[model samples]
Target: MQGLTPTESISFILVFLEGILSFFSPCVIPLIPIYISYLAGNAKQVAEDGTITFHRKKVFFHTLFFVLGISFAFFILGMSFTALGTFFQSNQLLFTRIGGILILILGLYQVGLLDIKFLQRERKFQIPLGDREANPLLAFAMGFTFSFAWTPCVGPALSSVLILASGTGSSLTGNLLVLVYSLGFVIPFLLLGLFTTQVLNFLNVHKKFLKYTVKAGGILLILIGIMTFTGWMNGVTKYLSKFTPPALTREEENLPPEESDTASESDSAENSEAKEEPVKTPAFDFTLTDQFGNEHTLSDYKGKVVFLNFWATWCPPCQMEMPDIEEIYQEFDKNEGDIVILGISNPSSAEYPDNADKSKEEVLAYLEDNKYTFPIVFDETGEVLQDYFISAFPTSFFIDKEGNFFGYATGLMTKSQIYQALEQALAATEQPSE
Candidate 1:
């Protein structure tokens, strides 16, 4: 989530808040007593005044087990969405459209525009609540299994969160966001379980507010569906970017190295001092082997431009833009080593689920299959990628002949983008002293 923008952070916040609101939804608020009774213990003691006998410790223990079950269910769902998002990185437009469509359908169902009976049907796990023994494991299973029950209020929120997760294009980030959203839901459920007497009374008094809250959730779902469909989330973030911390953008990538907000920062003093004005970013030096086990080093290519790229074979965008990268490399004067293009491959299955644990032979095979002519190196330890603070795939770093970082782009680059960065690096290398 290195590239997380203000808009995305805000989205996570909203999702979490929605989770909390789910507790107050009509379908859920009315079920509080059932949840409390089931989670606290099946066997209950009642007082003469009809006040349930409170066993706080037992309730907490059983509720914790229930929460764990809920976590397991949500975590898996979140991860699945994240993986799907990452898999569709190449076709983000298509992915976004499909995700948007799904959200729209769910939203329509919420707003009463589309009455899907299957979606409306109550599908809760049957735990045989009354007279049953206080079984923690059973409660846990109920919590996990019942997440798919699809109540009106929770359904919209769950679908909304899934769309948001899929939009991020990173599994770890998607998983974490979903977990935060789940926390919002779980906290309230836990509170209800813990303090049955107080909350039950509160729910009774505010009974009329429950339906309205569900409506509010539906409205929110509709709004999110629109944003997801139009890809306005990023647009909103871009608009607010000035007040927020620096973020990567395609517009920024097209600019010269001097114009990049992130690329200009020095990794070390040796790279160059970080300056408000033009300053050399410490040069990245590494000893890496190409697919042919040929040794290459930054120092070896001294007095030449290194168009360093961090990429993975599994990445769609990476694959999409590589042909352009190869074209640029082919035009370079390799005989004099005036310009070098080295693509550093991060061979991790987590980074590319479909292409994990790539060996030298596999890497070579992939390059050959693609007919790529540019030089390629495998970043086995992955330190090279982290050293560069790579926030996205298909990132490129332009190193000047002086071995200083010139400029970089965090995503796919056009042939013109590659040319512009090269021209800037060449210019920076020959920059005159004061």
Candidate 2:
């Protein structure tokens, strides 16, 4: 099997961060202090001055053992999920649907719409020995028990890992992958334990900030839930294929053409034809309807320079880039006949049930809430996305006025970058440069 791509590695790192954030959730956030306190209490007695002194070496080793224990538990969980996924690979869609439903239920729980008794269960593991006699193995067991008991708090993060594992199509590999994910969470906690007093003091002073942070974390979980349950992640992946390096696209394009040839002579002829045919760079065309029911086709503005964007209300990066897109849009909207800017709302499936036929009303509400006033379209059925082949949020296509595609961006674009691209597109239009 091919090694994971750079993009996949980056995505995994983001997954790791998501795991860390989930570990710092409301239920788990406040308890970090308590855990530290418990560990601190286990410290050895100080001199007669009444100061408590901890054996730093012992503390460090204990924390490390605890992290190892937590990591082991997650490794086992990942292995189990991977095995189950392998067994059910024949029913991939059924598994995906089931996972989606479970994610949705979890989201509902986060939003206070639903609750599960088992999910609320929080059992702590205890070591039946003195701290002085505590073996690393016992500490590790406690760590495993801690992780198992806190399943609800870590469910969102674990779910993400499980989703990735299931998609990997290999049980052992997938399980190991999630074990790495568990380390991403455990490492931070172990470090915090090393500076227990400092961290506890900081948390105590900034308790209000911590509350909001946990709230934000909860909201993020909810977002992840929506993305998972609605199949938005799959859609994003599909869209991202559009921006895959040209080499991969060319190779893929030639695959089907090659498969169709039977005879050697036919294959030679097809190869000749392939050599002659220019590699076509991907482009996007979509129809957007305004609140007034006016329809606009991106292709209709072909003779004019255009900026095409894919975005959604719930996406933070999308939202962050909007004001910049809007600033550029305003500059060009005034010169609409020369440059056209079209922003398309790419809602996750959970947010848009009808898919491509997503209502114009919802778009309006989104616009109003986000304070965006650009020419916006809805890619409910993802037909427009199919043409563009985008994978990430805020993909922008810069088309020259002569209908020649100049270039595109796959992630968030800064205001200056948008302006620079627009300026380049405009200059290309005026000079007819390659």
Kindly report which residue stretches of model 2 are placed more than 4 angstroms away from their true locations once superposed.
Answer: 1-282, 347-362, 432-434
Tens-digit lDDT track for model 1 on 1-434? Answer: 12212112334666678678766654344344446656655434567996655467777778888877777666655443245533433243454555456555655665578877554432111222235455688778767654533222354455446534533424455677788888998898787667855554454457577456545656665665566566553333223322322223333335454534234333222233332233233454789888767878987877888888777665667788889888887788542557899888856444433222365566778899988878788777655653453434666767778776555555566787678667656765677743
Candidate 2: Cα lDDT at 296:
83
Highest lDDT: which candidate? Answer: 1
Give the CA lDDT, 0 to 100, for residue 227 in model 2. Answer: 55
lDDT of 2 by residue, 1-434 (tens): 01111111224555566667757654345345334544544544446984444556666677788788878766655443345533433343344455445445544554456667643321111221124344577668767655644444455456445534533323444666676678678877788667754554565567677666544545655554455445555544444333433211111123342342233235434544554432222234556675446698767886788777776554566778888877777777543668888877654455555343235566678678877777786666655653453444556767777564565655566676567567656764586322
Backbone clash count, each prediction separately: 4, 8
Number of clashing residue pairs, candidate 1: 4
Cα-based RMSD of candidate 1: 14.5
